[model samples]
Target: MASESLIKTSKYTKYTSYKKISYRSFFVGLLLFIVVSLLFIVVFNAYSGSSPRTDFHEPVNLDSTLLEVVNLKSDARLSSARVSNCTYWDCFNVYRCGRGGHDKITIYIYPLKDYRTESGTPFSQFSKEFYVILDTIRHSKYYTSNPEEACLLVPSIDTLNQHSFSKKHVSQALHSLKYWNDGENHLIFNMLPGSAPNYNSVIDLNTGKAIIAGAGFDTWSFRYGFDISIPVYSHTAEKIDSSQPDQKNYLIISTQLNIPKHYLEVLQNIASSSNDLLLLDKCKMDSDRIDYSKRCEYTTGRMFSYPDVLKEGMFCLVIRSARLTQAVLMDVLASQCIPIVIADSVVMPFNSHVDWNRISLFVPEDNVKNIVKIVHSVSKERRGELYWQLRWVYDKYFASIEKMTLTALEIINEKVFPLAARMYEDWNMPEHIYGPVNPLFLPVTAPKAPGFTAVILTYDRVDSLFTLVKKLVRTSQWHEARGATPAVHPMFTTFIMCDANRS
Candidate 1:
């Protein structure tokens, strides 16, 4: 009987110890949970004041007006605020753009000549550039098939390569479109837009009210608000991917054929004397080629190709010849070679949005003799900065056919609908400054960027200083509590403390 009693006692003791351990573990976990919760709250409160937030109001079961600001009534605004569903570009999602902004700035692409559609390589395409332009818009947020609902219209005719597309053929086709209406509300994309032998800046077509988004717009030809100056895109912009050389072979490279005798002489003199310039002319005959094709060659038995050769030079010369706008400008930029543009009164592509002076060196035609000294005068640091900036610009705006087409569309979208326009920083600034943005929402009223700075000057009063910081923290909490995303500016705090002990 004593043995049985001892066994029961031992079991009872084991059960009690297990219960104690359970209680201890529960309490430890509870403590950790509380600590973590408090840390998250503190971090949230600290960061509440300086976060970037854009305000938007989405009404459920929205109507069919373009996304509208809460209270904008200007003619510059798209459609009517009261009746439009989607009015802004940034605030569009599948639901908003597909259903709402569909009616806002709706772009309709005219059907191409029979058998030439956007899908699966139409048996014939004007050029890859033409196909790219059509395909991009078709996939964009602004496309529509109902001409009745379209705000902008694009032509189906091929206007990309002037050498291939006859001006007469394009004009006749454009005139016959079912919705041409004398080219009213139409936007045409033309890279090289005139007849050759003397490719005039004029499009040489009866475009009527159509806006020319062409590359060859000199100051004399570009109608300020009516036209858009677009980039002369390289045929092989995407294929070339070269890392910048640690050391370049030439300070400047000029591959312009058919330049004036004086200009050619000047370049040759610079090349021979300083050995810093490379003047390349088209190969009169290539023993390597059984067929004749373009290959730039220097007289000293050195042959070169555009862009590839451009990578070997620090700067590429873009001088005015028969044409003000040249393919070499975009070519050099893509190769990360700085452009030395000498054309006077030439308005560059997307000039309303881009700062060309930031990436290029522009000199007057009269300054041709001092070109060497001018390029030499630039510091190494400046050259590095310019090349890096050029890379950024080229990638964002001119890298591929898709980018060029989309950039033009975005510009036109902004122009017609001023309220839905992209910000200056969106187009010109580096990504790190603002980061990649979808432009999901915009302010309801006049959008104002919010900045906050808290200045606390404490003179020998540690307690008051602490109190001030606590109060500032509470202000951010107030915003958070009000259902607003609180973003304290990154540069939000400045402390000025004078300690009595220091004396």
Candidate 2:
């Protein structure tokens, strides 16, 4: 009995010792798992943090002697472009701000001259604006020097305006440039700001000025521009009079002395009827000192600074001048004022991209009497919708100088550059280096003849054929009936023919 008892004690001790060992083994495995997990997390985080930094670093080639070659003679133009190469100290300077470096495009400024108008008005303002635009948006890169090394040459529209060079003369001059003589480099012509669209592409016999066709003119194949101007407004005055009760009413501020007679009559009629409508007309503007014509001398009315008037007005009147698009449009939009446009032919900048009808109300010039009626007819909900839409347009298109410059560059890249590339090579380049050649304005020819010739055959169906012939001939005059422009002059010509009559 004693031996059996001792054996049981020994078995119990061994079992207890085994249990203790099992517990320690479990704890050891758990510690190893925790340590491995912590190490993996630390390594993963380090790699992830370092990867983005390496990816974002701009590619730099430090070798000064290794020049980034921009071969203009090579017609290897890229259709999909994101990054532009700017040469710095003879090394390739790549900016990642544009689309990824695939399908790269190189842009350079023609450094020959600072743009100027014939009146000695310098385009330095635009140049400064453009440089800032390129920097902010990183859409283009500039070469320090040498037009020959650049594929695209951008000259300020104001410079062209100063030369009073028509598209033909400008084209000729571009052709005569030594760069063109090398059968390389193309000029992207910018039309003068605030000038009326000159659709008559041909040089005007009366005025030597190049008539930049109105914005959105189909015939304007080569001309491209962004006409955005910051408003000259007094913020202090606007804040001071913010509490005025009539501040939210309609205002028409014309700095020009002579508003169009039709537009003037319309304003007069609106003022005669509505006490809410304010007419601030002045014959002379401060711009007169700058030599820009404000208006012809005429009977004047009260004058108010632009911002003060713009602040008080909720609905502003925008009249179309020779300038295809006006600074007033940008001002009204930027101020968040609803625009009531009077010109039917007025084309908004980037019209092809955005819907203007969604943001502003357009009324025909002859229908000035309907101004108050239209304003009153708008529902409160609709007005709110228009206000938001106008605010959006302003923010996106003209909110800041940087944004405006970006807009111009976007237009060039999306609309102008591709078309220019296709048409650029087709231009009449001068034969000799610095050779004189007639400027070949684009589309290469006038619009195709408007009319088509049609032949009709009658086979013993005289009465029916005669009626059909009459209708076809009458269809030629449908444009005149609709009061359309003469651009649609003759629709078609008709010829009547007879086969042997079955009778």
Candidate 3:
């Protein structure tokens, strides 16, 4: 009160002395100040955009990271080839009070200026894979523009390809985020992470405590129940022509380059004995440097498109090249080519929810010699079944950026709110098989709508009346639900006045 009076007498009066300024003048000036403040608040809100969504029913709470990785069964481990008895949602534990179901998030993009301290940065340095990841999250149902209400956070730094930016600068960018309190509930995505000499499975950027949604994660680097194993995002995979008819002329196709000398020898020996195996090596160019976009030569001089050639083979070889997680895996899946993956340590994308046995054949790195024998063992009928199943699984879970990103979000959301999380069937089942999904779970028996009734009157028809009553008993559960479907005439009660019998 004293400060306000002093401001009104001194500052508000300007050059006028405190004695010269009248009480009316001071009151007028105060009224003008109040009006200006109100206008400022309205303008600020107008520029700030819409209010946060109120549909969320769960409360937000923070806690420690889930540490259930040690207790996981070998079958459920990320590095393990096949799916286990438990779904992805079943294996995780939330140590905190609030994390998912009601969890909402926003993406915080560092401006172009942040990319400066990183490298000789260009706007074009950001790959399409990076744009796809950002677009996928922006279009997700759980994203909120208001950061104040976000329970989780995403950073936009083109981390999809770690080689695109400097690790030190990227770490600095992470630390500069407004909500980054040791990366509590933040998510960092990396599709093609580490670079040359040592192609480490996971990127080595200082992500603090953020959840790593990355590809090429080995069992050692994977946070088991927490971190997500994503597939290498490939435009070739996304651009596969679905309209083309299915064809399988070759038994096994190996298009991978730069394999170990010993592993290459094994594949060569197998190809020598079998006419079905189509092995390809780098094409001989005039110059020493390889053009990656050019397809490898299958025959001496015959060259075909890399992934398109995969469609003609029953099984495509996913050999570990520069990295454990290969772009060829996604292309193989997209082309409906059952993957004979030889990367023994790689955690396949969404391995938690996907029953890899249905879509892929995980061959141990030591079993390179047996790959041909394994392909021959499967009958033509079984191969055809796998072909269709592989396509279904690919389109459902790993088709595009949207499916992959949403899969990660859903997994995290389920981990946080287990009670309201999606069931196993929801994650693995065919979308059409499950029919429609509704958030409201109708009770087995519900309250009746008042004044709604069914009446029946029949004379000398006790036997027929008995049958009718039995039918009604069977359908009683449906009508018991208050406001049940067929809103035209709501059902509630049943009244049967029948003939009095002496029996």
Ranking by TM-score: 3, 1, 2
lDDT of each: 0.69, 0.46, 0.68
| Top-lDDT candidate index | 1
Q: TM-score for every candidate vs. truth? A: 0.62, 0.46, 0.64
Model 1 bad stretches (over 4 Å): 1-104, 114-125, 165-169, 284-299, 433-503
lDDT by residue for model 1 over 105-211, one digit each (tens)?
66777655532212322222357677778888887777776655567778766766666653444455566577776666777777776675777775666676677
- Model 1 weakest 10-residue run by lDDT: 75-84
Prediction 3 TM-score vs. true? 0.64
* Candidate 3 lDDT, 155-232, residue by residue in tens: 656678766775655665566566666666677788887888888788767776677889998887787777888888
Cα lDDT of model 1 overall? 0.69
TM-score of candidate 2 versus the correct structure, residues matched by position: 0.46
